[model samples]
Target: MWNPKATVENALILLLLTLSVMAKTVFSQNCQNTGCPGLKECCSSWGSCGIKDDQCGFWCFSGPCNLTNKSYGFNYNVSAGPRGPIESIVTPSLFKRIMSKVGNNCPAKGFYTHHAFISAVKSFQAYKRTVAKREVAAILTHFAHGSEGFCYKEDKARGKYCSPSKKYPCEPGKQYYGRGPLQSIRWNEYYGAASIFLRLPLLKDPDRVAQSPEVAFKLALWFWTTNVRPALYLGFGESSKRVDGRLCDNLHPNDTKNLVNQYVNLCKILEITPDEDARSEISAFWRRHLSALMKRCASTRASIITGRYGLSFVR
Candidate 1:
C-alpha cells in the first residue's frame, strides 16, 4: 500500500479532475442574464451553451437551433463571390448614414469601410442570392447594434475563447478573443475552420480580422451563413435568439424590444416593409438605446470574462 508510483498516479488523477471542473465553470454558458458568447453554440432550456442536439434542439434558446444540431458549417465556398454586389443594398449613402451614428473618435469609424464590406461580399457569391431584403436588413440591424455602426474593431477585454481539443489543442502563446463585426467568436475550432477558406494563419494570428476591414466583413459573413441563416425563416425573433438566446421569449424584453425596433427601421431604409411579426418602427429610439446597452454589456463582461480560460493554456 505504501507504493510511491501509485501515490504519484493518484495525484495526477486528482489534478486532471480539478482541471475538468474548472473547464466546465469556465465554459458554463449560463445565459440566464447575458447570452452565450459562441457564434454557433446553443443555449438550452436549462441555461447552458453547447453545439449538441441536446443543447441546440427542442427548446434551444438561440444559435443554429435545429433538429439537425450537428454542425459541418466550416466548409465554405468563395467561388460564388462578386456575382452580384452587396453594395446595391449597402450603398455609399446608406453606409454613411450608419457610420454617422458613431462619433468621429470611434475605432470602427476608420476601420469599417464601404469598399471593404463590398470586397468581403464579393468573396461570398451566394450571400446576396440567398438573403432577401428583410434578411439583409436583419443582418444590418445586428451590425449596427453589435459593432456600433461598424466602429468597434476589436474587443480589448475578453476571455481568450479557447477550449481544450486534441485537433486544436490550446497553443502556448495564442489567444483567440473577439474581433470582426459580431465579435462573439472565442473558440479555436472556429479560428482553424475560418482559416481554411481565408488561407491565412488565423489560429496563430487572430488579430488579422480586426486589423483588415475586408477580412473582418468576410468573417462576419462566415458567421452568419453558418449560424443564423438556418433559423431566420421563423421570424425576426428567431434571428435574435441566434445572436443571443437570453434576449428572447421574455427573457430580456428590454433588449428584445430594441432589436425588433432596429430591424423595423433598417427594413424601411431598404424600402422593404416587414410584416407584423417584424414589429416595424420608423423612429431611431431603439438605435440609441441599443448603443447604450451594448456599451454597458461590454463593460460588465470585460470585467469578468477572463475567467473563461486558463492563462497558461490559452496564452
Candidate 2:
C-alpha cells in the first residue's frame, strides 16, 4: 500500500512536466504578441485584417463582434432613412440579395448570371441617382409577374403567338407568344424590334431569346428603357396607362389597385418607405385604396381582386 502511493505521485509529476513543455511550445510558436495595422483593424479567422462586415463580423475568429457598438462609436439612424451615401450602380451581389426576398419561391431561384440584366438596368440614366434601386426593384417585381420568374416562354398558350402584321410578318410555322422577360408578346412588333436592336434574327429564331440568358434579359432591358421608364418615373398609374392604355378603365377597374398592391409589396421588400422613415407607408396606401377599389370592382364584375396579386379575399 505504501508503494502504490509513490507510483501515483510519479505519474502525476510526469504528466505535469509534459503539459508544461507543450504549453511553452504553443506560446512561443503561435501566441506571440502580434499587432494589427490599426485599432479598427479586425483580426479575421483567416488571420488577415479587413474592413468589410463580411471580413470583420462573421469571419472573425471571436465570432460576430459589433465594432460599431464598441468605444469607437458608430450609430445608424434608421428613423431618418438611409443617412449614408447610396450606390449609383447596383452591384451583382447586392442585387442578388435583394431579389432573393422577392423571388424566393421562383423556380429558377435567383437572378440569371449574365451581364445583360445589370447592364440594361444601368442604362436607365434618369433613374440612376437615388431612385435607381427603387426603379430596378419595381421593374423586377413586374417582370417576376409578367414572365413568372424570368421564364423564357409562357407556360400556357392556346396557339403560337404569330402576329399577322404585314410590316413584321411572322415567318412560316413560327410562334411569338411570350418569349423573354416582358414576354415580347407579338412577333412583328416586339420581337421584330428586339431582333433589330440585338441584330440576332430574333424574328426567325424567336427561341434564341428564350435559350440565351443574355438575350432574354436584353429584351427585358429594351422594353423597360424604351417603353416603360418614362411613364414609370411619374407613378405606377402612369406606367400602367403607358403599357395597357386602360388602367382601371371599364375593362379592368381593380387592375390598377391590384397593381399598386404589387408595387407596394416590392417597395416593402426593398425597405423603401414613402417619406424615407423606417416606418412603412405602403400599408396606409393599401388601406386607403384597396377597400374602395375592391368595392368598385366587386360591383362591376369585370375586374376582381384575387389572392394571386396579394389582394385579401373579398367578402
lDDT, candidate 1, 68-130, per-residue tens: 322221111112112234667788998878777778888777788889877787677666454
Clashes of each: 3, 0
Backbone clash pairs for candidate 1 read 63-242, 80-125, 108-151
Q: Please report the candidate that would top lDDT against the real structure.
A: 1
Candidate 1: residue 129 lDDT (0-100): 54
Give the residue spans of candidate 2 off by over 4 A.
Answer: 1-89, 98-111, 123-131, 151-155, 240-262, 265-271, 274-280, 287-315
- Residue 281, candidate 2: C-alpha displacement in angstroms: 1.4
In TM-score terms, which candidate is top?
1
Error of 1 at 231 (Å): 1.7
Q: Per-residue lDDT for 1-315 in model 2, tens only?
A: 469889999999999999999886554322011212232343343444446664455333211123222211222121223321134334567556545554555544443553656555444454344444456555665665556545323434424655356656777877766655665244345677767766778878877766766676777766666655643333443333233211223334254544666666655655675222344365545433444333222233323434444443221
**What are the TM-scores, per candidate, against the unseen true structure?**
0.69, 0.52
